[model samples]
Target: MNEQEKSDGIKRVIPARYNRLMTDPLLREIVSGLDGVAEALAAKQQANVLFDELGTPPPDYAREAAGFIGSGKVDKDWIGRVAKDELAKLVRAEQRKHVSDLINGCLTQLDSIAEYSVDDVLAELDTRLQELVQPLYAAGEKLTGVDTPTDAIRRGLTEEWRLFADAAIEYAKIRAAQKIAVSVAPEEFKDRGQSAACEDPHANSSVIANIAEVWESWNTPPQAELAWSDNDEGDRVARWVRPRVEAPWPVQTDEFLLWCIRNDAELRVPDLGQM
Candidate 1:
């Protein structure tokens, strides 16, 4: 795909302004801070869910908490870690489906990015990088040490990492665009997109997908897929990397803000003289 076509693909997935935010330093920082805010706010909003669990205790918690107390580290360190751990699980449970769908959607896009005429995207790609990559324009620069995206990508292979499998840059305008379609509305995919978990909360676990749904959840690059993830459940699970949304509040917040800045930016009317 040529540059103009590449640019068009990005426009379909997100607003052009999001691209600017990713490149520009100041706006990027502000977006990062807002992501932090989102995580804290989501936690505050869901705090009651955690407290509600107090009436019932898990066997592990009973043992751990008791051990914690006996160990003499009973101050803020003990209770704080326990509480934080529990909260992380809660967030993961609610967001698992969200994360899954993001994976499915991005994969669907990646599947046929070349033929994607306001309809297609890339095929099975890096999870977090996939989220940022429809263009994979930014990260490739230093890794390949080439100026243009095409050359850098071609060079990326000779290096250590593995992201691009030579997907077309565009069939339309050429520019960087988000690969993962999280904030994107599903209708945009014309039903070719993966179904979000929310739409079918009770899906059968035994359906036996003839094609295996990936464990990576499309969160990490291929080389990093070997990494483990907790699903924010605090237990190590298979071939997936931890998602940004499930990170500690500060980190989660930064990621969300950056995503918003890129995909769903609002008009930032400056305070100007009023400030």
Candidate 2:
């Protein structure tokens, strides 16, 4: 199939698989729980629920206390202070439990998808995972009194998703390489025969080595920038090299570059300059 067809196929298959995976019981439960938590926070119902759980004082006792205070003409400041302190304790306890449950549920859901192979399905899964957890993190931050709980949840979610993103990118490179390798025949190059004497024997080797060096230093894929310059012979040639940024290298450095040159016309390699 042509390149467009291959891309289209991947797009279609990925979403289908993503939908199927979301149907899994564990994932659905986590998603539902997160949604419920978000709704509760949005509607400002958590405080109301907490108040209900604290329960009302008996009517007879409240009436008798009010009468006694009225008869004594005593100041109500001490009673108000005590009630405020008690309410604070109850609010904190309830919020902590709520946030803890949401975080635990998210982590559990992530564990279920931890074994998924890095493919198109993973790309979608990572996106959905982020969507499911981020709002919950926000809710946690809003509900919890201290930053520690929310910070811990954010770190946990980020670390887990990062692993999936890394694996997905690596898998994509492998699949792209396999596709290009199959499309281009080795025999096609064989007929071109030996290199011309005037051509730089070390051109491809030097370029390949430089590319490898860049890859080795990278912590992520470099955003390769393309530029063109005239050689001494006055012929304009293309060069697509990594941007001078601190990031990781792409997987299979040499193969990925070669595949780009072969498959992407715009990224075709230009004649090499003298080393």
> Considering every candidate listed, which one attains the maximal lDDT?
2
Q: Write the per-residue lDDT of candidate 1 for residues 1-275, one digit (tens) a residue.
A: 11122221221132232333335343343333432334433553354344334323222456766876688765557567668767876765555434433433333333222222222211111122335344444434344333333544487543312333232222111112222222232343322322222122111111112102322232232233456568676998778442222221112222222332233322111111110
Cα displacement (angstroms), candidate 1, residue 78, comes to 3.3
Q: Which stretches of candidate 1 lie above 4 Å from their native place?
A: 1-63, 66-77, 92-97, 112-275
Model 2 over residues 1-275: C-alpha lDDT tens digits? 11122321211112232233345543333333432334533443443455346543323335556776779865567467557756776775566455444533433333333223223232343344334333333333333332232443565644433433454454344334322222222233321321222132222322232433433332343567888999999999999976544223224433233232332212111111211
User: Which candidate ranks first by TM-score, i.e. highest?
Assistant: 2
- TM for every model, in the order presented, reads 0.18, 0.21
TM-score of 1: 0.18
Model 2, residue 44: C-alpha shift (Å): 16
Question: Ten-residue segment with the worst summed lDDT in candidate 2?
Answer: 266-275
Prediction RMSDs, each to the true structure: 25.8, 25.3
